[model samples]
Target: MEDQPEHSVSNEKSTAVGERQLHRGDYGAETELQRHLSTRHVTMIALGSSIGMGLWLGSGKSLASGGPVGIFLGYILAGSMVWAVSHSIGELAVLYPLPSAFVQWTGKFVSPSAAFSLGWAYWFNYILTVANEIQVTSVVMGFWTDDLPNAAWITIFWAVVTLANVFGVKVFGEIEVVGASIKFGWIIVVIFSLIVTSAGGAPGHGPIGFRYWNSDPFTHGFKGFLSVMPTCIFAMAGSENCGLVAAETRNPRRSVPRAVGSIWLRLSLFYILGAMMVTINVDPHNKDLFGQSGTNASPFVIAYREARLPALAHMMNAVILISVVTTGTIYIYSGSRNILGLAHLGMAPKQFKHADDSGRPWPGLVLSIILGGGLAYLNVKNSSADVFSWLSNMTSLFTLFGWGMICLAHIRFRHAWHAQGRSDSDLPWKSWTYPYSAWWGLIWCMVLIVVEFYLAVWPLGLPPSAKNFFSNYVSVIAIVVLYLGARTYYRGPWWIKLTDIDLDANRRFYVDTEIEKVPEKGLRGKAEKVLGFLFN
Candidate 1:
């Protein structure tokens, strides 16, 4: 690809010379992205990204390795940690409405070293995520036919998502909204089915009633718990896509917070409780999670099969396919947004920041396609199981690392806010449990990282599995190299101090919207009145 003049450092030099005369609260007056996503769009996007193939398929591994207590406790703790991270991100996104969203907060509030590692690390995470999603989708495709090569299916889906992204975020948001709503409802159905069937309502099992938990509850105790943390973390990877999309969300103060808050409900109801079903139903020592039964390795599918519901099992497999494809689309959008963020922050060539009139960042989209599509060919030699394992380790490690950086950045932001003598009243939204919550979240992140490291290098102080060691720590190696390289080139401070933090550069204070008038008592009122009474 030929480099264009618009992307040159010379171009940045000329553009930097023009002074923008702006008053207070006008720092982010204009953004290249269109804020077309409504509250429903943002909310569903978050749910869609979070409640996908991870829960449907990956939880099998979580249950197999960690057992009942481990899966339950791990998700509970990780869920709380992610909630804290999202809350911190919500506060920052509302205050500074810009492209690249929270990744830029690391530069302003934490350190440029962090921004460099986190910004590209997150991009890499999503790039690999897109590839993983496609490979998983192809695994699901095998349930029907292996006539089309895995690469063929990967290319087909990749092209579909890229076309939607090119059309712009409006198309992307609409597609995700519809997909998320269906998957969200389906998760509720699966949960209800699991409870009912486990109680002997489905004919094959007579009140299994947490038998798996009572018999072998904690598999291999804590060491086993540590081993599965990466898989559990992988299942929760895309939750942060919400904050990244805040740049294109309408009324981010409301949309982003609503999206962030919903994560708790999603995690508690879907992930944590879903783990409960797997632990109660599927054997903790089950080998299916490693795809012994192919992509239908989902314990949920196994549960359905056990309950004399082969059709239901197939239906759930279809849902997993749908979920993986939807996640694939979302990750493409997320990965492109990260590159766009990097370019805007001057870490990438300026050309990547260029968006079409439709508000699509063209070059960033191209880069995402290249990374995702190029990685898809890995499926040709290695099976989806091998590919998923390798990708999960990196994605999980970097995702947790990204979460840690978010908490660190927010801690610094809050410190500076207080140090500057600013009132919390000036904020659009305030998270509960201030400094304590941030620290609580951060401590857990460190715990997971340490546990993962121990599980990889020494299982109960035993020798490390050379394969697990490298697979699990690849992301850590990448981040260290990236941080050191960036620190060497742009060395300044190990940490950005509160007093020196730039809080004004992107202080986007939105004008309050007029409230909509209430509808008169009539057909509309009758419909809502009956619906409301039934709902109440």
Candidate 2:
């Protein structure tokens, strides 16, 4: 599979864009994606992908481990790293805008083995995450009914999402937009209320100020801070999906950069400001409030409780449940697409290559649903409520691994581009601080992986309940084994041959540049451009 070439490059001429004509078969595919997704859909989808259960439930764990300062710094560091990775992906997405952006790019720019390993790794990661998200949804629902087994809710939710995807991609996009809108709305309300309450409003609690951090500035100290970095990084991990969906967006050349550029704003508003609000409003040392029985004591919830707004806590919980469901839907969609990409490339079973008349990969969607539902059921039976926690941590390792691979691939891609004498202007979106940003992301991911490995093994200051010190490392180990096995079987050396990397050579097969347009000037044109910016 690694050695197989998906397409052959020919010098025929076909298709015109405005005034320019593309070489015949510029993009590898014969069919073009319909531009059904608008800018709002794309932006919200990106936002939704990054701000799910992690921010709601996982933040408490990070705070418990690292305390306030730890959680704050971990997010800052990780957010910066993710920003770099996102930019790298954005650059590639704009240039190619293929269905399976990352996997396809890896196959073309690095080695087929690299692409195969990455595709499987990312697919497996999302599958596990979907299982985890469903489990979280069940747990949250249990707050209302403990008698109903989580597995039942898991199956129901999985079925609903499966049916949604089978209908068409547009359904998925619309659902994501609505889901994200709810979550984003809830966040805005929470943030606004927190600020208002902190400034001495509502009943009682006179100008709360930063009294929460007075006694224990750093709850767990340096050890705690180091421990929380992994989870913090996980929260910001999937923002690059904006680029992944670039192929489905209209005018990706402009849309992709706009999406990528939004990362900084999101980090500032969502991660940094959100974390700050939680830390300043809720004390990390509130042991009784955030202990084991209080697993659902998200820092956000804790803040509301502190302000004597118990009702808001319930509302937040409901919002969180919806967030989990929305996130699961997105995960399944992405996982199925990854599988479809693999099938198209001859790496996965051809059954996954089956697409409906509307271009939705029904076979892959069904497979993802069945697998996700089965995993959810098995996890419920074995681990019960703890399934989501376990799967979430395990998936974090793979997320880091995926980010690291992207950075490395971009580094190689830039080198190859320079070697081929291609200028940056020829690219749709260019990543700034070449090599530096990519290297920073790679290094941070490596560091976090090592630290996570140590935490999983030593346990050190961690709670004794944390099990299987090596479980989180399983994904990393699996990736290594696959790469080595593929390398040995292919009779290839450990080093990759850069020139042999296809890097979108097949993309020329389907890219219809004639349909693509350059932005126009004036108010009406600018308004259209602004609207176009939202889809991806």
Candidate 3:
């Protein structure tokens, strides 16, 4: 990744450049990351990150508030918007395939102030989230013993996940692949178990099928549905990490879309349907379903026990412990890459973008650890339940805004791409549903967020509490504050015109146009093509 002389991208050339190595990026001078993550790496990362504490722990909130049916509806609806956003970001990300996905694009496509807001907002969102995940790990471990203090467990997990991220992208990818695969397989098993247990197939139960669903499909009605949204929002928030890893991924144009395209199907089967299974098997009135009992309180675990599988429930609890740590490791890396992206935009100091010999973002990782790792210590004095509640309210809406920004920026980028006389097919991955799809995602994400906010802060409903009001709406206030602050400090135009964007800036130094088009002449080629289509 030594400096290969910088070259400008040709405007007349097509946007779809096929699979290629990434040496330079649209990010400023510090684009020395080693492109090593494969399609499986990113796909699993997308899958694994989404299946974190949200499903393992937060499902309690979704079920307790929304009940089975309401929570399922919430996930499916929110997931649809995220699905559109995935395609939107995939199309734009392949253009530059840089770290932090939609972050730097705002500067060139929208305005400098806007880009600053998106970049820092995304960075803080993940970094702080990583800290919260670590705190939850200490709480999850408490399922086994209270012998060790929360601080000790927090320190241990903080160091382990930090090293995993700093070890390099390859190491990070391998961990996620294994962790996510296990989680996926476990979900499938849990689904089967739920079906069986509900059918009176287990030892103690006698055909509980549809009993819970028929009795209490909607817990708190419409307001309850809104309450579960933050949990669903947090569950669906991590898919964008696929795009954030673009700069360090091989053949992003192919890998990113391949990963992004699968998000909806995964959510349908894993999240929405998984919750449906819990509804069929577990009683909505169960106190443990609220996640107050830590790992033991997980609906998945309780579902296993309902089937007379206590040992299996405990084992799944152990698996959840590993999944939490794995996800925390990935977010730490992702957050740092975002910081590196900011440096590339010259929005932050150059040191944050520095890379070591293995293409590890040393400075960025250190900063993430300093901030995220330090914040994890909050679990020492406060309870994990309280910390999780605060973190959830603060961050639930943040990444939704990130997705909205991606759609908005993509709308602008598409207009500019067409205005320059470029056909949609010329792009590596044109969002076929473009303009309409992006608008659909952008508008709904905003509307749902507004409605959810009102549900939380509304005077009549929900228990009156400062935590409810502040935690839920603080992110909105923070975004406005950051935008105004950036606008004042940067003092730039409100929006950059489509024609003026430096499309030529930071084009990858390497390109292989024949990546997907290579002929399948030999048997080896045919197998490779099939595998490529499956993964690439």
> How far in Å is the alpha carbon of 83 misplaced in model 2?
0.5
Clashes of each: 0, 18, 2
lDDT by residue (439-520, candidate 3, tens digit) is: 9989987986797578657722458677677766788888888899877766535777677665656644435563434345
Q: What is the per-residue lDDT of model 2 for residues 1-536, given as tens digits with 9 covering 90 to 100? A: 44545442111111112011011212223333456665556667776777876777777777766777778888899888988898788777777776667876766666556767888888888888777777666756655677777778877788776776776778888888778778767777887888887788756477867775666657777777876775676677678788667767766765666667767767877788888777777767665233234545567876776778889878987888778788888888788777877776656787876676776777777778878767877656654325645676678888887888888878888887777777877665687767789999999889888987877776635554434675556777888887776454433334345554445454422344534454377763564465455433
Kindly list the per-residue Cα lDDT of model 1 for residues 350-409, writing each as its tens digit: 787777777787788888888887897798898777687789888888988888888888
**Best of the two (2, 3) by TM-score:** 3
Error of 3 at 179 (Å): 1.1
lDDT of 1: 0.76
Candidate 2 lDDT for residue 525: 56
Cα displacement (angstroms), candidate 1, residue 399, comes to 0.7
- Candidate models: Cα lDDT each: 0.76, 0.70, 0.76
Please give the range of 10 consecutive residues that has the lowest summed lDDT in model 1: 18-27
Global local distance difference test of model 3 = 0.76
Which residue ranges in model 1 land beyond 4 Å of their true spot? Answer: 1-30, 292-296, 459-467, 512-536
